[model samples]
Target: MKYDVIVMGAGHNGLVAAAYLAKAGKRVLMLEAADEIGGATASVRAFKEYDALLSRYSYLVALLPDQIIQDLGLNFETISREVSSFTPYKKEGKDFGLHISRVWDKETEDSFIELTGSAHEGKAWQEFYSEVEKFAQKMAPTFLEPLRTRREMKTLIGQDSTWEYLVEKPMAEVIQSKFKDDLVRGVVLTDALIGTFASAQSIQSNICFLYHLMGNGTGEWKVPRGGMISLVNELERIVQSAGVEIRTDAEVTQVSTDSVGVRVQTKKGDSFTAEFLLSNAAPAHLDRIRGKKSESALSGSQIKINMLLRTLPRLKSGADSRRAFSGTFHINESYSELEDAYVTAAKGEIPKHAPSEMYCHTLSDPSILSEELAQQGYHTLTLFGLHTPAELFETDPESSKKIAVQRCIDALNSYLIDPLESVLAKNSDGSLCIETKSPLDLEKDVRLPGGNIFHRDLTFPFKEEGDAQIWGVETDDPRIFICGAGAQRGGGVSGIPGHNAAMAVLAKG
Candidate 1:
């Protein structure tokens, strides 16, 4: 039997790609190494006496097209909206809320200037930021549309700009140049490194900042009501409705290709053949499998930790009790303190300073998360942070992975937590209290390398225009395309890559 397309790993992108293909009247097959979908856009069942929100609202929804939501008829409760967040700052008996609302714009801007004495400099900061925002708003279309063809992107840029012009300029310089205040500069620079491995000072991170603004999951993030998994059931409905086959516990172990197209060898020796293939599995997993297709064109990966807590934390004098613990909490106490954390991370060691996290997925829409927990009568939390150098795991990991985690928690206390005595330890190693999971742990289970969520770094060289970069989705093989985060525009709940890959095969095949 022949298939018009075979999509591997039913991740958000892969599902979207397959669904679109089937909708266009193509025979689409989506395979998953695991029994479930929704990769990092996932929720774990509680084993301990605590609570957890079924779905996190500060989701990768920004990358999702508004029309896609409407067309899918996915549950309306699955999509709710409210104001986004508050970055709490309490130090030296002072408490403040870096409210993420547009209303807080004036106060937030004023507080930073006053805190850093940036107002004494000039009005240049005001003019520069306005321009940056305007430029970002204009480029919104490029971000919303998936890159299907070089010709399509060419229209967006002029022939005059050089490749270096696109990359060489640093994002830190862009923000700092406008504002002489170091504190204000650091605050603006925080946006640059949010979902990346690069520091504010790192190269090409300015682009990462651009994408961060795109998601803007700000304004009280929301979860699709009922349960986060309701999204899976809805998507599954669409897939089945569109005639896409479903399989669970049906893990693909090998992928082979020839003049006859492709053969997906499953662990049970069950064989799946198709004319075209798209993989939603992590790049790390797909790259390490013992097969021809296992050589995923991926370079490196990242480490992640998700937790469910019994109760929220308490901050001392400088802390804001009422500060909205909405989505993500930024824990930078000082400039050198933030840099020291990154410097330590570069050395494959955790910094002994506040490494930035008090983040709860609750900020998106805390009441929803709270209500969900109340229904189950337990308190839950999901915390995400970045540590480890870009290529830290390039070589094999030494010793057990637990040592590295301890170092990450230690790094948090150096500055952010006062006296180091007040810090609440809630499963510091991600093992004692909660079930620990990472890209490395998932490798044996799903056959991924370092268990990287995106499967490749979206730092640079991939998202830039006029470049023939093959980071994730773009490949040279006739019937090949990447559907997971390791593909184009990686690592988010957005299903753009999957959607784009299907459209490409539909147009070219």
Candidate 2:
């Protein structure tokens, strides 16, 4: 079959690209290797014994633009989280923790003061985030616009020192200089390390940090009204309405491009021809499928844990468990600990104390669970362990996953009054209601190429000299483009790559 354009994957980005192209009157066809769409931005009935729908891989919503939501008339909704994060600390024989909420109140201030033993650190915390808020506001709009150089962006930021500190220097330098408390610094630096293997000291770490903060212009991470699957289902509705044809389980075996157009061959011995091709697969994966050698260094560096809990675990810090688990419940993620974990993982060994984060999805959006489960006080917990690089599990993924899950549970247990196992829901067969996906598992499940969630190490959002201007989705082949997280400015559930790829194709006329 022939088409005006053929998208290589039906991931969220691919769906966004196809929707836009078809809306612009282009005949589009999308082929997905998996039976379902959304790629990592999907939800699943992971536990058969439970009635909860879990956002399997990509859990939260932040980077997706309001412009896309409005333009596509998407029927999706996100619930705002009142509490931003809660990090537990034990010192001076007291149960203390830092709780930052959407609004600054006396209780939050008191928590910081108690945890840090200084009002100055609390003041610095507010001042530091105020700067981040301003920076996010200035940079968020630029994401949807044409690419800008580092110089141009610096000028937009309007302060040489701020630009140098944030964009040019390592995130660690800025974080250390701005915040003195170890736990506070870690809370801020955690943004820099999500899905990235690099330490806070790495210059490249600043890019990851910046992306995490600039989502939606306010750095607010939100939960989908239902689950991540609803977001994908809405995009699918948009694309189908625009007359785009979609095929599943159609893995592309080879891609051939010529001066005129491109041809995509599937493993099922089917051929698809199109004037243009947009790939939602990782750049490295695309290279392999096209039988080309790729030198891209891409590897995922986090462990994802999905658990169905009978109830929220009681906290050792004496804070309300509901509030502690409402937002990001950080565990052993101090700045120094994060550094040590990075160093240990780089040596191909799991850190003695893993830095992880968890959140109760039901706390924010209880609609993901059925009425029976909600009445039963059941909740879903999504835990992510940082600095557990792909190398650590290379030798023995099965054993590594078991050890990693245990370490994460142990780390959480330190901050909890009752053990994590005590709150775990039982499966039909009487097993613990918990599942984990290592980087290797991500590679096998999503073809992420080294299990890197963002496809490859993230690049600067702007284009360099002699780079493609069509939304930074262009490749060496003019007839082909990238619409996945591997594309420039692509990561998370943003769908920026997809929208940009469609704009690139539309600009061809």
Best by TM-score: 2
Please report the candidate that would top lDDT against the real structure.
2
Candidate 1, residues 176-259, lDDT tens digits: the string is 556665444555555556545666676646656655555432212344444455556677788889999867667778877788
At residue 492, candidate 2 shows an lDDT of 86
Look at candidate 1 and tell me the lDDT of residue 449: 50
> Model 1 misses residue 458 by how many Å?
1.2
lDDT (Cα atoms) of all candidates against the true structure: 0.54, 0.89
Model 1 RMSD, rounded to 1 decimal: 5.1
Q: What is the lDDT of residue 328 in candidate 1?
A: 46
Per-prediction TM-score = 0.78, 0.98
How do the residues 1-509 of candidate 2 rate in per-residue lDDT, one tens digit apiece?
36999999999999999988999899999999998888998899899978899998999888999999998899999988889899988897767778988788888899888887789888888887778888878888888777887777777877677678878889988888888888999998899999999988897789898889888788889999899999999999999989999999999989998877899899999998999999999999898988889976748999999999998888888899998898998999999999999999998899989999999999989999999999999999999999998888988889998998899999999888989999999987889989899999999998888889999889878766666465778888888899999888998899899998888888887
